[model samples]
Target: MIDQEDVAALLGTEGPFARELPNFAPRAAQQSMARAVQHAITERETLIAEAGTGTGKTFAYLVPALLSGERVIVSTGTKALQDQLYFRDLPRVRSVLDARLKMALLKGRSNYLCLYRLDQTVREGATFDRTQASQLATIRTWSARTRRGDRAELAEVPEESPLWPRVTSTPENCLGVECPFYDDCHVIKARREAQEADLVVVNHHLLFADLALKQEGFGEILPGASAFILDEAHQIPELAGQFFSQSISARQLTDLAQDSLSECNGVTGAIGLVLEPVEAMQDAVRRLRLAMDALPERGPFHQLEAKREIGDALHDLREVLAALTDVLASQAERSRGFANAHERAALISERLDRIAERDSERDVRWYELFPRGFALHATPLDLAAPLRAMREQTQAAWIYTSATLSVSSSFDHFARQLGLEDPQTLQVESPFDYAKQALCYLPSGLPDPSARDYTDRVIEAVLPVLHASHGRAFLLFTSHRALRRAAELLQERVPWPLFVQGSAPRHRLLEEFRHSGHGVLLGAASFWEGVDVAGEALSVVVIDKLPFASPDDPVLQARLEALEQSGINPFMGWQVPSAVIALKQGAGRLIRDVHDRGVLVLCDPRLTTKGYGRLFLNSLPAMPRTKELANVQAFFDDEVSAPA
Candidate 1:
C-alpha cells in the first residue's frame, strides 16, 4: 500500500531529512509542489507548475512520482540532465524512500554508436586520409571494449570529428529492424530497456520525436507510461512547434545522398540507380549553398525572396531529387537500405515542392540560410489543436513544470500557447531569501541596447563591478557577435581566467569556471538558462542587454504577423511576455542557493526608460534594485566582511 502520510512526512521538516541529517531543513514550496503533482497523478488531470530555482522541484516531482505507483516518463530539456536523472537523482530518491523501482534513460538514435554503420564505413574503406584512418582505428578499438556502444564513452575522439556521422544513424538513414545488424543495435537495446522499465527519463527532443512516431505509426519510447512529467516545461510550446512543422534541410538531403551511395555500392544495378542521382543531388546541394552564400548571414527569407532567384534553384534541385526518387523506386524493394532512402527522397521532394509552392494558409512558410546550407520550414501558427489532440489521445496525466513558465505567476501564456484547456497551474516561489541573496543592478547613463558602441559602454560600466566581485562573473550576451566583441575588449583588461564560449565545450567551461577560484566566463543564450552555480564562485551575472527574441527570426516574425492579423497587440501578447520569461531566466542565475549573493546587472537602460519594462521587472524575483556601482561594491564588501 502507498502511503500519503509518509509522503507528507518525507517532505515535512521533522521527517526523513530532519531525522537523517542535522543540516537538513525541509522546504514548504517543495512539499506544496509535491502534493500538487501527486494530486495531478491521482486525478489524471493536465497540470502546469512554475517552481522557481532552489525549490528542489526535481525531487518534489520525483518523490510523488515514485510513491504514486504510476509508471512515469520524466522528460527533461537536455541529455546531460537525462543521464544525471537516471545515474544520480533517481537512485538517490529510491534510496531515500527505500522504494524498489526500475528506471531507464533513453536518448535519440544519434547518441548511440551504430555497429552496422561503423562496420560498413571501416570495412568498405570510407576514409580518404591518414587522419580519418587513425580516427577510425581509435573508434574500432573503443567499440571492441565498450559495453553500451555509446559514442560518448570515447573521450579521445574529438566531438567535431567528421567520422562520427559515419558511425551514427539518423532517422532517415537508419535501416531499423531490416538492418542485418539489428540484433546488436545500441539504439534498439536502449529502447528495449526503456519499454520494460517502470519509469523512463527522456529529453524534450526525444519526447517530441516519439510523439511524431506515434502519430505516424512507428516504434517509439514513452508512449504507455501512466503519467508524463515535463521538467523545464516552458520549452514545450517551442519544441512542439518544431515537431509539428514540416522541415527539410540541405544537410539531411546531403547526408541521405552520401549514405545511400555508400550503402548501395556492392548491390547489383546500384551504380546506375544510385550513383547518377546521388552525384546530381550533391551538385544541387552545392549550388544551393553557393547561391545562398550571397544572402546575408543566418536569417529568415520570405516566400517572394525564396521564389525569386533562389526559387529557381530550389525548383531545379527538387526536379533532380524527383528524378532520383524515380530511379530509387524501381530498385528500392531489392534492398531495405535503398528502400528507406527512396521514402526519404520522396518525402523531401514533396516537402520541397510544398515549401516552394507556399500555398497553405494555416502554415507560415519561410527558410533560413546558414553559412554552409539552408532549410525550408512550414510552422502552424497555432499548436493548440494538435497539442490538445495529443493530450486527448494519451490516457496519461500531463504535468508541466519549469522555473520560468509563468508571466506574473500566471500560466495563461504557456497554457494558451500549447492549447492546454484550463490546466490546473500552481506557482511555487523559490524558498531562497531572494532579498538577501541577490541585487538587481542597472547601470546608469548607458546608451540604448541597439547602439553600435553599446557593448563597449556595458563593458566600461561592468569594469568596476567585476573588480569588486574579484573576477567571478558570467558575462552573458544576446548574440555571438556581442559575446565576441565583449570578450575581445575585456580579456586584456581583466586580470582573470577568461573563458569564452566555443573556446571549449559548455560543460568544460563551467567546470573550469568553478575550479578556477576566480574566472569570468563570457557566453550567450545557452548559458543564460540551464546553468546552476552556487556560493562564492559566482558573485555576479552581467547581461549585456535584455534578451528579446530577434525580430528577424522566422518564427518570431510569423508569430507577430499572425497576431497582427487577429488584431491582438503582438508586443504585449507575444514579445513582452516572451522577453520577460527570458529576462527572468537570466536574472535567476544570480540566486541559486540560499547562501548565494550576487548583483544581477542588466546594462540595458530600457528597464527604466521603456513603457513595457516594468513587465520584465515585475516578473523577476522581488529583490532590492539599484542603479549605482557603489551600492554593488558595498553589498559585496558587507558579505566578505560578514561572519561565517
Candidate 2:
C-alpha cells in the first residue's frame, strides 16, 4: 500500500492546483480512503466504507484508481456528481498524475443524440412552428461538428420539445448494427470509448441497466474493471429494483401513435394505412382514462374496484400493439426511410407483450393514472438475485460507500437487502464534534403522521427552530403531499422567504436558497440525500415524520406480503431499518462541515412513542439531544451570537 506521506508529497508535486487554491489540504479521512483503495487493489476483497461529508472522498478514491493501472468504473448516485467527476475532478487528477490513462464518461443513451433519428427528422422537414424550424436548423448545424455527439451541448433544447424523440433514440427505437449511421451513433461512440478507457464514470441507473443487460447496445459494464466503486451506495437497493423491473406508460403508447401518424403522413404519405392502429390505441387510452375517471380522485390503488375494467383496457391495448407490430414488421424491410419507425413500433409492441404476460407471484404489477396519462408498471418484489449475479460476474473488489448505509451501526439491514453475506464493513463516524455542533429536538405532543393536523403540528414545531436559525433551514418531509402542505402552512405563518420543491428544478431551488441566505426550503425524498449546503446558508433540518414508507404503498405492501409469507416480521424485517436509514439521511443534511453548526428537529413524536424509535436515535450522529423546545432556541441563539 502507498504511504500517506508519500502520496501527499506526490500530490503536492503534481501541481494540478496552485498553492493558493481554496480547497484545504487532503485531510486524515481522505488519507484513510487512499489506504483503503490501495488495499482493495492489492487484495481483491469486497469492502464497505462510510466516509463522512468532509472526507474529500472523490480524490481519495480517484488518486488510487488512476494510479492502480487497472480499469475502474466509478458510479455515482446523481447526474450532478457524474458531471462533477467527468468535467471537473477527472481532468484535474489526470493533469496532476501525468498518467496517459484513457478516461471516458458515459451517461444513459438519453443524454446522447441519435444520428439516424436526427437524419430522418431532417429529411421529413416536420415543424411544429416557425421557431421550431429555426431550432431544428440550429441543431443540424451543431450536429456536424459534435465529435462526442452528446446532447448536453445543445443547451437551448427544451427537454419537453416534441423534436427530442425525433432526434434521440430509445432502446426500443434503436437499430443497433443495422442502423445506417451506427458507426456515427453518439451512444455507440460513447460505448466504444468506454470499452477502451481505463476509467469510466457512470451513474447508478446506467450501471445497473448495463449490469441487467437492459441497455440496448452494451451487455454489461466493468468487463475489464479490477474494481467497482459505488458512491452513494445507499440508493443501490432501490435503483436495482427499478432497473430489474419493467414499465410501460399510456403516454408512451399515445406518443407512439402520434409519432406513427406524423411519420406516415410526413415521410411515406401513408397516413390512411396507419389510421387503424393509431385509432385503436387512442380508443384503448380513452377507455382506461374513463375507467380511472369513475374511481375516486386519491386513494390506495387497491381500494378502487375498477381493476377489472382497467385490466380489460390493458388487454385491448396489448392486442392493438400486436397488430401495430405486425404491420410495421411487414413493412420494415421495404424502405430504408421507414426502418427506424418500424423498429420503434416493434419495440413498443414487445414491451406491451411483456406487460401483458401475467405473473402470479414473482412480480408486482400495477397501474397509476397521473394528471397527464396512465402508466403500467411491473416490478420484481426482490432484486437480490440479479444484484448477486452482477456481483459474481464482476469478480472484482467492490466498495459501497455512503454517509447513510448502516442502521444502528450495523450493516445487517443493507447487506441482507443486497444479498451480500458477511461482507467486510467499516462505519467511520464523522469526526466533527456533533455534541457541540448540533442538537436533535423531538417535540412531544404532535399527532401521528397520518392525522389531519399532522402537517400543521409539524409546521408549528419547526416555526421556532426556523425563527431561531433565522430562516437558514431545511424542512424535509417524507411525502410530497405532506411537504406541500407544510410549505403552504409555513409560507403563511413564517416571516422568512420560502422555497418549495415544485416551484423550480431541485438544483435551481438549492441555488436560490443558498443565494437568498434567508429562506426555508421545503423538499422531500431527493433533498434528504445527495444535497450539500455548507455554512450558515443551512442550519436547521426539520423532519415532518420518521421517513417511513407508507404501509399502503404498492411496492412496500408487496415486499411486506412476501416477508409475511416467508414467516418474517415485516415491521422489523423491512420498515424499522429502512426508516432508520432514511431518518439519518434527513438528519445528515445539517452539520456538513467541521465548522458547520445546526439543529435537527424531528416533529413526528414517534421517536418517543414507539419501541423502534430507539433504533432510529442510535443510528443518528452522537449529537446533544433535547426534548425541550426552549433549549433548541437558546442553542441557536448562542451559536449565532458567538460565531465568526
What clash count goes with each model?
0, 0
| Residues 483-531, model 2: lDDT tens digits | 8888778766877888999888787789899999888899998899989
Point out the worst 10-residue segment of candidate 2 by lDDT: 12-21
* lDDT by residue (tens digit), candidate 1, 1-644: 34555666787877775576455568888888888888889889888989989888888889999888888999999877887788878887887788798888888888889998898887887546988888899999988888778776787887778899889998888888888989988898898888888889999999988987787777556648779999988788889989988888989889778767866776886876688888988898888777777665545546436546676677679888999899888778888887988899888889888877775767877677786788888888788888888778788899999899888777778887988888898998888887887888999999988898999999999999999999899999999999999989986898999999999988889999999978999999999888888878898999888888887777777778888999998988988888888888888888888778889898989989998888788889988999888899999899889998
The 10-residue segment with the lowest total lDDT in model 1: 298-307
| Candidate 1 local distance difference test against the native | 0.84
lDDT winner among the candidates? 1
How many collisions between residues are there in candidate 1? Answer: 0
Estimate the lDDT of model 2: 0.78
Maximum-TM-score candidate: 1
Residue 34 of model 1 has an lDDT of: 86
What TM-score number comes out for model 1?
0.96
Every model's TM-score: 0.96, 0.91
TM-score of 2: 0.91
